[model samples]
Target chain A: MIRLHRCCIALLMASAPVAASAASPIELTARVLVEQRQAAADGTTRIVLVPPARVTPGDAIVYTLIYRNTGSQPVPDLVVASPVPGNLLYAGPAEKAAVPEVSVDGKAFAPLAQLRVDGRPAIAADVRALRWRIAAPLTGGAAGQVAFRAIVK
Target chain B: MMNRILSPVALLAGTGAGLLIAPQALAQQVRSGTAAGVSISNQATVSYSVGGSSLTTSSNTATFVVDKKINLAVAELGGTPTIVARGATDQVTTFTVTNLTNATQDFRLEADQQDVSIPLLGTDDFNVTSVRVFVDSNGNGTYEAGVDRATFIDELAPDATVTVFIVANIPDVAGITQANVSLNAIAANSGQAGTLGGDVVATPLTTPDSPTTVDIVFADDTGLLDQPRNGQQRAFDAYRLGSAVVTLRKSARVLSDPVNGLASPHAIPGAVVEYCITVNNAGPNVANGITVTDALPANTDYISNSLTVGGIGTGDTCVLNGSIEDDDAVGADESDPYGGSFDGATVRATLPSVTPLVPLNVGFRVTIR
Candidate 1:
């Protein structure tokens, strides 16, 4: 990363006068930082617990999830999911994106909730998020956020 | 004392009178009644005062009126007389325009508009907002080629191309493999807006709306429907300006009072209605024995707006020196916004003071009637 930074600085110094068509503005040292400005419901119902903003090589980063329903309505069955980051275990309590029936890779998902609908526990497959699913399908006017982290295997 | 000699009836009558007099005395307690009077004669003199409140008091007269009672006086809008388009269509087929407002709209329509409104959807879905054609008094829809209508712009000069229209994503427009389209171009009219205020937005609005939708102007974007006129007879027949030439396009602003809701029958006190009027060039051409004239509509009373015409011939300015006259319509109705009260109307003329030769800029009315 240090060498990459030095290389970027050398490249910037080589090209002068052409200000606009320069390096990517979102790059931090090397990799581009993806700014996902996802809103739960307009500005009213939102839950932005990075749940796991950072993760160590082998240690799981814990998140204290806190969410509120700022609007006048309630939220329903919402699912939170994320691709299990490399070299980490989802530590029993998790919902992964991959599965034996659905997983392309060995990565699999397990729901963190046991919600019963119509007097029957909902199948765990129903709660798993897809490749690009949000933290949850927030209810009307209701805000709910959760916490999860990948532990180093 | 002479007061003690009063009868019982007189004492009772005096007691009741004293109670009523107490209010006037209490009102006068504010000091400074130096002999003024609010005339009980029922005659009201309205004046539009901008700076201070419309209130004055004297010993005998009190003229205290709220600001709401005063009419808003706006400057006469539109400086130079502009040619407003009535109903115009440029079609390869036959075209027709009848008076929609049922009044003599001072506008001209040139056929061969190169564009006309045809229902892109079902024929039932397409609507013609207006079709006011400048027809001959004889009532024949076809142009006599060289008579009544004037050709201001022809083949090349009538080339001010404008294309704007409402295109919807309805099913009927998509069904045709190939079809001819139509759209209507209307000359701007001076009256209430065609579309009511509510129809503008499908949803409820936080504010009320204007009366006329035609005034809701749209910029000309030739990109919408600019297909060349598919070979059509698009020419205007000319009108020879005669004694009934009726065209004196005079417009200039003079210092005048203000009036708002200009069409309203009753005016605000202290309102200086800056009246603006145009005696148009109902052209054919200015004839030798011509008497260019104009009549004011009766719906509104002429308050105080003077009329003047400048730059008549070369550098000559002329004034119509006389009291204006008002003509009354026999059985006119006032259900609509304009055309004044169902009474007599005032008329003014815009003729060059000394008519020797050349076109004249006859103007009138800088005073409230």
Candidate 2:
């Protein structure tokens, strides 16, 4: 039984690289963090971000995305796109990025004020997806991250 | 490098169809925020060109569940104070308790007496008797006696409003013009339908989110006395007094006699005597349906067609006004609206309305045998 189990594991390891080579060389990771307000000892309020243990409506959350180019050659035109969940409203970008654009219907991307929904100027709540285009080419073994803040509706 | 398998790239909005394109249209309908126990998932996709070849990959989905938000509102329905007469019973002051939370909940009701003056209402100088709280069982906004008898709300739906009442009895004590009362609604545990739930005393959780377990968060607005996030809310209403204070005085004197006609006479046998009863009202409101009766003395006969009402007078003197009334209780004189009549042994007068600070005098004549 042990020899059979080892043979099955060896066969799985052999096919793993074949699947990885067919996919993109850029690796992406996503995480969700909750924003909490704490009263400091100095009579000041401090905002702390922690992994969500209990999340209620009207709470603020930050979605962070990290990517790295694993290939030997430089990768160009790196674009990161994320959609605002139906249960959440897009507050704004957590950190400024290159050429950030928002979409009201997920198909048309533009600045928040430039986008219109049903003949009216679109607001942050109308945003369904967000995309950012990295201006600089990503060199091999280079890593970067992008984030956005959203409020649970 | 190992990669987790990801779902297909489809950016469809959740639940409602117009949630993405027309949030304003969905807002027009009554709705609260996201409900508890709902899972929210997020994923991101990255695309780039490697060595002149295009490539794309998606990230693993990050998900969390929404906890419960306990919120509600209590409001006095009427802007003006409820007018109540002195010694009035079961006078009702109405309010509305709304469940603003995202889930169905039961609310415990309480009635409290206040001493401070209500806004736009007079100062509260007295307390109402037998104060009680009740929920409107019948959907009607008005409070019905014995019909709307629910004491606490049961399983009230989210964004729904229910009427409540503070039923009390006004004191008969003098100079008590206003009484203030308030209703408080506290969040309570939900139980079987048509049953009052146990009190849900809020001890806010001190720890972080549990992700799988639904935690409670008090998000109610501040009340007149209660602070925000206390799971309770309160509102005040007042009862104003609308009553009349009336006083009566009676006096008699000799008018004339069969032997000394039109001269100074005494209360001797066969002498004609006149009795006057004055009705005065010192009130903040008019007195209605006032009736005064004076019975003749033994061995004395009621003088026919001598009854008079609404006579102008102060002290012991009175001057008869209008036409004279008759001896029979039934006649056009009795329907004069301010008329009097004699029923053999007694002289009776009826006045429909007695204005404030106005004196109404009733007079009749009788002859001693």
Candidate 3:
């Protein structure tokens, strides 16, 4: 009788798919990185990215955003939005694959030329958030990454 | 294709969310930059549509801790060197030590005498004795003799400045005018509120980064005779000699004679002759405790109650605008203030302190036999 009850519970758990299907089909990940200069064997210098062990003022930092489609269907209208931390100053976009739209007040978004801060033209340091939209649809099991550089204030 | 780098002004202008700071506090933060142990976290979100449905997913937060930047500044307080009199003790040259680190720090002070030339002053040619260092214990800018006696700085906060003094004794050396000294301050760990901590050295680059521990970095700029990234700074000052250059001039003038009356005075018998001794100090320092001695001329009688001191001197004669003194030197009239007295054959006069702008005069009258 105990085995029959355990089997009945397993059958009930195995039939529950409606609640799990409501989850999002895209996976997002973020990372912070720093660049280091190394003397190569060819008597040349090479720049490489690594995880920062310590961060101080005036140090340049990179924030990378990666997205992967995990569902069986393709995901369309994929938009990635990231807010610049208060203690970090936005330097510029690290990747040139897609130009990101920035917002100073987190309400209105536009190109770098159309934004203003305190009634003056906004520089890259005044950016509060950045958004990048993929021009093509992301297929199932496909991944893409976007990155930007910021300085520790 | 457009790239913009962050400027230093924008980095130090303002920070934090909804945090209001005063102008002075903002300036202090600019020196130390971001505080240590501050956590900076960032997260990204992605939103997409699938079959007429919208879904959103957020990334894991990526965070890093700000490390401690050990830095400090030492500066001489005054532009000109300290003026010290010869044989002066406990003369102080002031300096200010400012903590530019991101956290509270203790500073170890060292006062050293160098033979290098000080700016605007000549080369150091003498050595000072009993050199010592002191910190301002009461947060006051002035250096008190016995009150502010703390040697090393205790628990100095970021962007906060404290007064330091290098006190020494000036020797009475001839032909020696300037002595140069330097004050060096090294960053240290802050142990307690009123206690000094151990010295802090630069963290080696070979040490691996531990996410939980706050690493140390030397960010101090180069100072006088000090290297960069050493968590220390040094500044130089000098002590200039202040001495008196006194000049004495003596003159004699005939007052009156019994034969010629007051019309034509001559050095004849029964004539009163007055001798004037004028002392002038022309150096940058004042002279004190000056005494003038003059012997009566041969075959001359000393006039009683006619000796006076501290009078004004003109071109060649002494103006008798001084107090009268008796013939004896053991009475109250001799030193009531400024006076002179005659003792049988010689005259002695004592005057007050002589300054650079004023001349002290001593005058006495003698009768020719």
lDDT of each: 0.26, 0.79, 0.79
What's model 2's lDDT at A133?
85
TM-score: model 1 vs. ground truth: 0.16
Provide the TM-score of chain A alone for each candidate, in the order shown.
Answer: 0.30, 0.83, 0.80
DockQ score for candidate 2: 0.40
lDDT digits (tens) for residues B1-369 of candidate 3? 001112211332344223233535544565777788888887677777888776667677788888888988899998778988768899999999999888889999999999776555567888899999999888777788889999999988888899999999988654467799999999988968777788896667899887556789898898668999998999888888776767789988889999887778999999999888888875456788888888888998888787878877766678755677787777787657786777787888887688775777888888899
Every model: Cα RMSD to truth: 37.2, 7.8, 11.7
Worst 10 residues of 1 chain B by lDDT: B65-74
Instruction: Tell me the TM-score of model 3.
Output: 0.69
Candidate 3: residue pairs that collide:
none
Question: How high is each candidate's interface RMSD, in Å?
Answer: 41.6, 3.7, 6.4
Assess every candidate by TM-score: 0.16, 0.75, 0.69
lDDT of 1 by residue, B244-298 (tens): 2343443333333355434442443433333333344322233343334445533
**Model 3 chain B weakest lDDT span, ten residues long:** B1-10
Off by over 4 Å in 1: A1-153, B1-254, B258-268, B274-276, B279-285, B288-305, B310-345, B350-361, B366-369
Candidate 2 lands at a TM-score of 0.75
